[model samples]
Target: MALFNKMLASIGIGTAKVDTRLDSDRYLPGQTVQGKVEIRGGSVEQKIEEIYLTLHTTYIKEQDDKKYTQTAALEKLRLNDPFTIAPGELRTMPFSLVLPNDTPLTYGRTKVWISTGLEIKNAVDPSDEDFIQILPGPIVHAALLALTDLGFKLRQAECEAVSYKLNHHRPFIQEFEFIPVTGPYHGKLDELEISFLSVSEERAEILLEVDRKAKGLAGLFAEAMEMDETMVRAFITKQDIPQMREKLNQIISRYI
Candidate 1:
């Protein structure tokens, strides 16, 4: 019986399993997530090399005109040194992870999760995955509200590939698409897309891509020449929210 039990444990049939339990399901950027990882031993004694946590999220990637969802690790944490878990033993390790300021929120099909794993020699590793919701920081919320106040209705929002110049850890960004159906530029513009290039407590860089509607012969000629789309960069601060509408309107006026 002893020989059979050791054999089973070696193959992970009776090894330790890891599970992380978070206090909450929703977290804001720059906030701390408190949790505990519970390690439960199976039918026999097993040696756990270490315990680690990884923050992962899914984003869209394009290859050969085909879009695919890919998982990326945003952060990693190793909790402890090697330890032995006796048969049917239960152990708990408490932990906390600091959410990054640039972390993208959970919106428009985006998913964020944490994976906890047990590292054991000569055995199949055991892991647990739990999804969490990310909330937008102050700057992003303010910008969205300002656009709504400007008569722009959100049409679509998605996470898509972005440029390296944006200084982002992820290869993609969350783009908010809007259209002015009743605003000052209703008939003049087709749509507007906004992306947060970089954001901080004191400053943020936003990208605005505007598509204009073609009207008469002159407008059609400009459209045919591929001049109906314009991209503008805006450097703004929280204090600028009161005037952000006017600032964006001025930029649209030039294209309209």
Candidate 2:
């Protein structure tokens, strides 16, 4: 009993407590995430200036060929404004958050953390970080599998901050690079870069950049192209490995 009391004190439960639970452990892009944030009062009453939930993801920023870790806030929600919790009281607040469609799904299981916090002026700040697993959707997985089946190997993956100068919402672009399979075109293509934009259940924009190796007569050049929703859907779902390889080869041949 004495040890239990000491453990509770270490957590500042005598002040305030917070717990956030998600409705579902696994979620898809463009889906609403439902959760409950429960706050339990401690030995004494406390005044909370505000109660809010924040969603964050980690990325790497590259500058001058150097990389640095960066944490970005994706979304935020406010539950209450200046609320008072009396001693021996327990309160639970429900929250429904719609995750961004373009959120990157980790290769396998990515850990995404959400924080529920109560802001207090004098007392220790009480907060909870919940780790959620992010799984890749069928469309995304299919595309990658097709590329792999075609003999293209994954080279690198990274998230880049991109500005179109015409879009309203700031977009973070995740780029996947692959090495070409076999053929004269295999060595001819330095790498295949793919990007997903405006990603959602209904539609997604696909962007491709092909870096071509320079021939004796041809100079090194890169071609960039954007595919519409209909084309993207067709390419991901309908095309097979051979067809995908041909489609990519055709695109590369035109430039060379």
Candidate 3:
């Protein structure tokens, strides 16, 4: 009976299971995420080599005219060391993960989650996934609010794959898409896309892609040729929040 139990455990029939519970389901970028991992032993005893938590999100990638959603790991945390668990044992370990300052906000199709797993040799690893909401930091939040106040409405937000030359740490960047529905540039521009190049407590570096509205035959031709769009970079600081509207207006007016 003991040999049979060991065989079952080897095939994961009596392996350990992992579950993670977060203190909160929502967080801001750069915030410290606190949580605890729960481990429940299965029908038999098992050895856990390590416990790891990985932060993951999905991005859209285009290959040969086909679009694919790929999962990317932004960060990984290795928890407890090797330990042994007897039959039907229960263990809880507390952990904390500091979210990256550039973590994308949970908007539109963008989603973030934490995956907890146990490393067991010669056995199926038990894992769990928990979704979480990532809110924009203060600087990014101010920028979005400023755009809204300027009469722009958010249309969509997504993460798209980029060249390694552009971003080395991650293969994709999150973009916030907005349309000038009733603003001063309503008739002059079709849409505006914003991407955070980097952000910090004091300032945020952003990339703006402004798509000009096509006008007559010439405009239509230019649009078809993909020449109606212009990309510009801007830096916004906490001090600029009060004047963000005017500042953005000035920058966009030049292109329009």
Please tell me which predicted candidate would have the highest lDDT against the true structure: 3
lDDT by residue (tens digit), candidate 1, 39-128 = 999877788898999888777788899999887787889999999999889999999998777677787787888999988887789999
Sorted by lDDT (best first), the order is 3, 1, 2
> What are the per-residue Cα lDDT tens digits for candidate 3 across 47-111?
89999999999999999999999999989999998998888899999999999988889999999
lDDT of the candidates, in the order given: 0.84, 0.66, 0.90
Assess candidate 3 and give its TM-score to the true structure.
0.96
Give the local distance difference test score of model 2.
Answer: 0.66
Model 2 Cα lDDT, one tens digit per residue, 139-199 = 6666666567556788777766665652525445677777877655476666767767656
Task: Sort every candidate by TM-score, greatest first.
Answer: 3, 1, 2
List residue ranges in candidate 3 displaced over 4 A. Answer: 164-168
Candidate 2 wrongly placed segments (more than 4 Å): 1-13, 108-111, 163-168, 181-185, 214-256
Collision count of model 2: 0
* Clashes by residue pair, model 2: none
Q: Tell how far residue 22 is off in model 2, in angstroms.
A: 1.6
- Lowest-lDDT window of 10 residues in candidate 2? 225-234
